[model samples]
Target chain A: MKVLIYGSGQLAQMMYLAAVPLGIQVSAVDVGNHTVVDPISKRSLELSIEDAIEQADVLSVEFEHVPEDLLEQAQSSGKLLPNSEAILAGADRVREKAVLSKLAIANSEHRIITQVEQLDEAVETLGDKLIIKASRDGYDGYGQWRLAHIEQLDSLKNTLSQLDLQNVPLIAEKMVPFERELSLVGVRGLQGDIQFYPLAENLHHQGQLHVSVAPAPDITENLNQQAQLAFKKLVEEYDYVGVLAVEFFQVGDSLLVNEIAPRVHNSGHWTQQGTDTSQFENHIRAITGLPLGNTKAKGKSAMINIIGCDDYSTDLLSIKNCHLHLYGKTVRPKRKMGHINLTGKTYSELAEVMTTLAKFLPIQAFPKLLDEADKLAAID
Target chain B: MKVLIYGSGQLAQMMYLAAVPLGIQVSAVDVGNHTVVDPISKRSLELSIEDAIEQADVLSVEFEHVPEDLLEQAQSSGKLLPNSEAILAGADRVREKAVLSKLAIANSEHRIITQVEQLDEAVETLGDKLIIKASRDGYDGYGQWRLAHIEQLDSLKNTLSQLDLQNVPLIAEKMVPFERELSLVGVRGLQGDIQFYPLAENLHHQGQLHVSVAPAPDITENLNQQAQLAFKKLVEEYDYVGVLAVEFFQVGDSLLVNEIAPRVHNSGHWTQQGTDTSQFENHIRAITGLPLGNTKAKGKSAMINIIGCDDYSTDLLSIKNCHLHLYGKTVRPKRKMGHINLTGKTYSELAEVMTTLAKFLPIQAFPKLLDEADKLAAID
Candidate 1:
């Protein structure tokens, strides 16, 4: 079996690793070069995209932001999993918001603005405090702006006017006050069987996910059901196949949709060590029509992203259940170099491991570690 | 970091998978051709063996029977883990028996026969029922002859006389009646730290391992200690680094040394899902001078080898906690095609999953499944 992935990055590399033991060969298209490459070695496979597509048993994407032309090429092969509609829902905020509205799913009060003057009306209707985002190609806090107050609307509009708003519209979303962010990472098989990893509490630093604790502490049955229901509705609506991540904001008792990622997600990386089957493996299984492995969590887990720093001592592996997954990429500021997954019997135990792990990493590179560790330590 | 393993087989392929997540690249020596190749893809790397040896941070082997010239070349690089002596001990029965005797390890009462005339003395001193084995390149019940009764001793001697015993001597021993065969798969780090996975009870059909249950049922504390003590003594004596498996024959309350493998063993495949870290990953960690991950078992596990068969339905994956690991090998009689790992909270649960799994696999291919399931089902 062979799987071709659209984006050649860490996610594809991970999928390749998971797929190998299942007798599946995974080749990735370096969307940057539009050439097929080995996901791990990044070596050109010397095969054209057409050849790869034809040879693959399934086609998938590592990220939602794959170039449209390339995605179309993959989708037209009739092997693409999750379908192009699901991928586009994650790629374009406008399409995503439309799906949420059509499904009557709870999300932030938002308006799509194609013209500059519409920002004023968005502010008036939604709120003065809003997060304005580009409809496409927005990721990791890029292509976004904040309207903190009514006073900044003119300045924000002036900044936004530099772009062709007609070509790419803006999504002005009311910034809802929420307890914290949680992401439900789930997979839907070809047979419509769906399974979810426990909701993970995500910690963001500078609009990038820094750490995630799975089976987020203090989650009530009501909250879990709400998240799962939203996930079910969205996947079923798209007839989605493969892994989908729905990021949400817990506003008191309800979860509001923040975003959806149509691929294996960072927040669910803890599943590599925390669950019986990782999200990567599950995604491959779902797309390839294999029976999905168990999704049950083995224990509490914390996935701490190793951002932009490779200087940390490998001795941190001495920490029990601390597994390092390095991306084998050159260090660059804010690049997701890799992640450390730690598992424990309880949140407090996970916290202790995180605290110990923090000592081995550069503090500046992992700004959220100590704080998240402190928060989790107080839980039990 | 890079690791070059001798013998491009399933073991090396699995090590490649485990090593990738640690930012390590693993290449394999197709010892048969003496060419370096990608462990998983088996693609020619276009690199010479010497170049691979020089580039790798560590060198190891997938199988004990690597050609002597290749082992010597690897040892000359000063990068080989477990050293050459440890590997040679595993490759030759004579050397292995010598090492056991020197370490005062309890093994079978045996006599080395470099000439055919010694066979008659072996039968006079020991029992009439004896198993004779070639000292080198013996595996999977091959290169062996059985002397079932005093009357058959002359015939067995005639069979043995046909071989060049002077070059590859034979081990003639009384066939001791044992309760079961168990293997202790353990790893030793460069820093001399050691950890062991729980002993696995192996089931053989026609001398090929068809099933293995880890943390074997009905184990007493004393038996476990004896196994661990033997393992510690052997590894320490060799000053070994990387994973080593010591096979034992449990007789009454004691365990006698059967053989030792210098690399990861088949019985430990259950670690892939049933332990905090697998034997493959631990071997990588050990050779790379990294701290070893926890060796604690997560639950009861059974690993069923998919021998010479690829005709099973993958729906067995629908069984909770069952994971399929296919080696992507073309089926050949007695070939180890892949393995399925099933984990459960207890023996009974593991047995139930095994029973369900049997429905998906060919009965002839898995001769031990139903019987082992019955045994485990009666355990708890």
Candidate 2:
């Protein structure tokens, strides 16, 4: 089967690699801005995007942010996997929050703010502390504002009022004091069969994902059920087909939905090394109407993002059980260059590998890994 | 670093997949014919072969049979891994027999034959029952002839004498009535560190590899030692770098060298799902001077080659612990389509999965699977 993917980035590159061995041909739009250079050969193509898409058996997105017109074209063709509506829901916080509310699923308490006056009422109803996020065009902390106290709401409102909030409204949420952050990465097949990877504990730095440890340490039955329950509701409601990642904030024993990513996620990267079938492969499988692969965890795994570092010594691979995935992207500060997946027979072993890996990394390039490594060591 | 591979086939494609995550660029010559279509994009390239060669940091062969001239050019550059001499030894049975003799290794009692007149002497020295193999360009039972007794030798001689045997000679061997076939897949790094995967029990049908069970059932310390000793001899003698696969015939308490492939072998495919690192990754690692990865087997694994069929339902992936690797090639009779690597917690579990898989496959496509399944069931 042939697959056409929207947004040719590192995620698309990985999907391309994963799809090839399955005998599934994958081509990406906007990869060469229509010229479709082979990702491996670095050679330009003679095929046009029209021909590429027309030949594709299925259309999917590598990320949530493909332009709407192209998405509409794919949608009209009725070949889009997971559908454009689901992609839009992930792209827009308002729609995602509404989906959560409509399903009666637990999530952070929030109120949409369209005008400056609504911020006052949002503060009055929600709490003193707030996380104000733009409904659209926001990710990795961009277009997001946090309110530590009600006193700062006016300043935030003043800053927000200058921007045109008509088309993109703000979601003012009461920041919950959660015990930890976790995510469930799962796939929904065309037959509506759902299979979820074990919950992964996530660590964030500067509003970007820094690390993910799978089969999250000290997971309780209660937490597992809650995440699965949330996942079931989302998949069933959307009739979703393809990989969907749902981030959650664990408040004590209760798990509340944080947001959903309709594509393969970084938090699920651990599955590449930790599971029999990776999330990337499962995503392709689901999109192409293949049965979902087994999601059984092989062992404990930790994935540390290689953000903005080009200085990674190939020698780092010399370390036992350390797998490096470099994205081959030009290094820019805060960019996700790639990640290192360290798997072991136990949490302690993974921790030990992580600690050793930290020693090899540049402190500036790895802003959050050292601290995460320290936590893993403590766990060890 | 950039890697240039001699052959552009499934091995090169898999190597391409394995190397991408390591941030290494691999360009394969002779893959898309002289055009060198990018493996990832499947598009023709604009670059010249010389430019591709000059851009490469290391040159390696996906198979031993690369043209001698190309091997000479790569050898002159001093960038070839495993080197041309090792490849030539693997290509020519005479050279291989010489290496075995030099290393004092055990092999089938044999005599080189350059003329049809030598058959009678070979029979007198060896035995009536013999296996004769071509010295060059032979695989999968091709370029082979067999003799059951002296009476049959006349007919074989009549047929053999009609062909020119000047350049390419044959090796006439007394057919050893032993046990099962096995292969040792191992790697030697540029730093001289060597790692060997456990022996794999290979099952052949019509002289083609059908299935391989890794950490071969009923292996003992003596058998393991014998294989490792032979490996040590070959690696040390050649000062080899990159993966080498050696096929062996088990006879009682002894093992005889059958042949050697100076590149990753089909027998190592189980490593994809059954080891912390795969043979493909190790090959790239060894060539690029990266540290050799762990060769520890994960539980047990069996790999079944998908030959001459593309009707392989992706649903086979639905089987637990089963991973399919399809070569993106046109379907043809007797062509190796791809392979399925099934990993399990025990020999019994792997056996069970294999048996279950056999039921789903066409009988024509899987001649040995049902029998292997039955054996596995008995073991279970």
Best by lDDT: 1
Error of 1 at B198 (Å): 1.3
For candidate 1, the per-residue lDDT at A332 reads: 94
TM for every model, in the order presented, reads 0.99, 0.97
DockQ, prediction 1? 0.88
The best candidate in terms of DockQ: 1
Please state the CAPRI-style docking class of candidate 1.
high
Per-prediction backbone clash count: 0, 1
By summed lDDT, the worst window of 10 consecutive residues in model 1 chain A runs over: A68-77
- What tens digits encode model 1's per-residue C-alpha lDDT throughout A5-92? 9999999999999998888999999998889999999889999999999899999999999998998888898999989999999999
Could you give candidate 2's per-residue lDDT for residues B1-380 as a string of tens digits?
A: 89988888899889989999998988788743665545554454567667878888998988898877778888988888988999999999999999999999999999999999999899988989999999998998899999988889889999888767888999998899979998999999998999999999999988899999888888899999999999989988888999999999999999999999999999999999889889999999999999889899988898899988877566678789988898888899889989999887877787788877876777688887777766765664
Model 2 segments beyond 4 Å from truth?
A: A31-43, A370-380, B31-33, B40-42, B378-380
